[model samples]
Target: MATPTPPVVPHQGRRRASGALEGEVLAALQRAGAPLTPREVQATLSGELTYSTVVTILSRLHGKEVLTRTPRGRAYAYAPLTDEAGLAARRMHKVLDGRADREVVLTRFADGLNDEDAALLRRLLTGAVPGPW
Candidate 1:
């Protein structure tokens, strides 16, 4: 007799990349341009994440100083301390913080930038305030 094949099962939900949820939450908060309660944030999200999960993400971000929270009735409302660009800059600074060879790291980063970005960086470094590209 031929062996029977096992049944194939599909994944119930799509897997997200690391930090994707956090990024999504941050984007929602930024778009609000105002503090949001956990319930509000959960509603703003895709409804995949739970209220407790949203609260947890907000608490974690507050701990990281990425977000600020204030008391609102029984729950805390959360707001981002900085915009997306500011968050990216913070991440870059964090990556360079403890390195003994920051110059090398910066050199590698500069070298990796495309011409347009390189020129933009040069203009910024030279104290020229150019309009947004």
Candidate 2:
């Protein structure tokens, strides 16, 4: 019999990804419910991220239109374009829009759904139910 693999453990002092911080920043903005400067974002993270790193991540997300930024003095203030569900919906729409065959892609997606999932999707599409967290 093959030996079972050990569970992976995160290493200490490994370089954490900027994408991880981006989620944190997005959550912070959502929680704040207002635009925030990079310094404010860094502060919200409680010094876990450096000022410059946070600035770069914010700028990158803004470039992707995931976050909106407006000039605040010398730097910029950032806010999320939507809540988590809205963001996910936007991404799905973007992917569908990019593909030439919307019918085929949507057919495949709908065909893969279970009965319960299909019902939920119908309710969601008709705005008869709230979105998932």
Candidate 3:
């Protein structure tokens, strides 16, 4: 009987900031106003990152529905389905909605903000007041 080979194990450690790369790629696409191949993204990153790594990240992001890709010759050009802000808002909403008490969740969210952020949020909610507080 032939011996079976063991399955390969994935690297375990701090996970890659795949979300950040997706955001960056999306921003680059928005700036370019067109689809970009992995090579293009690698060139844009310059010496800060490796081409193959960027390609892998792009492929993973594309699989995650964070990005859309179109075949261009032997390679694919990828673009983001939504902007970073929209993606972040969707994720935040998902997290908040999963809670049992939405009111408490929102209250805690407000309370977690820094003083400046809280004040700014209050101002936005109440609109601009001409007089000083």
Candidate 4:
């Protein structure tokens, strides 16, 4: 009897990159240019991610202020608040709002600034033209 050959199976599905799913999700939202239901976002990912996984990631991003969530019927819709600069501002506001002593927080923040950044902030506060980017 001839030996039977084993059937070969190719890789079944897409593999998630080590840390690129967040970028993937964010990029998908930016490409969408509008709030997306988690299901929609998952579809944009070619269904590589489950619906619950997409929703969980969205919720986590919203909590981190990286994405904004709006009420949408039985679930929330998600969209990026803005680019990196806007996210930094949102995080700053979140920290400032959560504090009981604004002065202490501001002092600590200012203390961490280098001379160049401090001067830039001064010029910003005084309505002076900031140094060229």
Which candidate number maximizes lDDT? Answer: 2
Error of 3 at 39 (Å): 1.0
lDDT of 2 at 108: 100
In the range 14-132, model 1's lDDT, one tens digit per residue, is 87763898888999999999999999999988787899888888888888889999999999999999888888889889999979999999999999999999999999888796654
Ten residues in a row with the worst lDDT in model 4? 11-20
Q: What TM-score number comes out for model 4?
A: 0.60
RMSD of each: 3.2, 7.9, 7.5, 6.7
State how far residue 99 of model 3 sits from its true place (Å). 3.7
Residues 1-133, candidate 4, lDDT per residue (tens digit)?
A: 9999999989768877634877789889989999999999999999988898888788878876788888899988899989756666777998899999999999999999999999889988897966433
Order of quality (TM-score): 1, 2, 4, 3
In angstroms, the error of model 4 at 61 is 4.3
Off by over 4 Å in 2: 1-12, 124-133
Which model scores highest in TM-score? Answer: 1
State each model's CA lDDT, in order: 0.90, 0.91, 0.79, 0.86
Give every collision pair in model 4. Answer: none
Rank by lDDT (best first): 2, 1, 4, 3
Candidate 2's clash total is 0
lDDT, model 4? 0.86
Instruction: Report the lDDT tens digits of candidate 2 across residue range 1-133.
Output: 9999999988768677777878888999999999999999999999988898998889888988999989999988999999998988898999999999999999999999999999999999999998765
In angstroms, the error of model 1 at 67 is 0.6
lDDT of 3 by residue, 31-63 (tens): 776789988887776645578878888888777
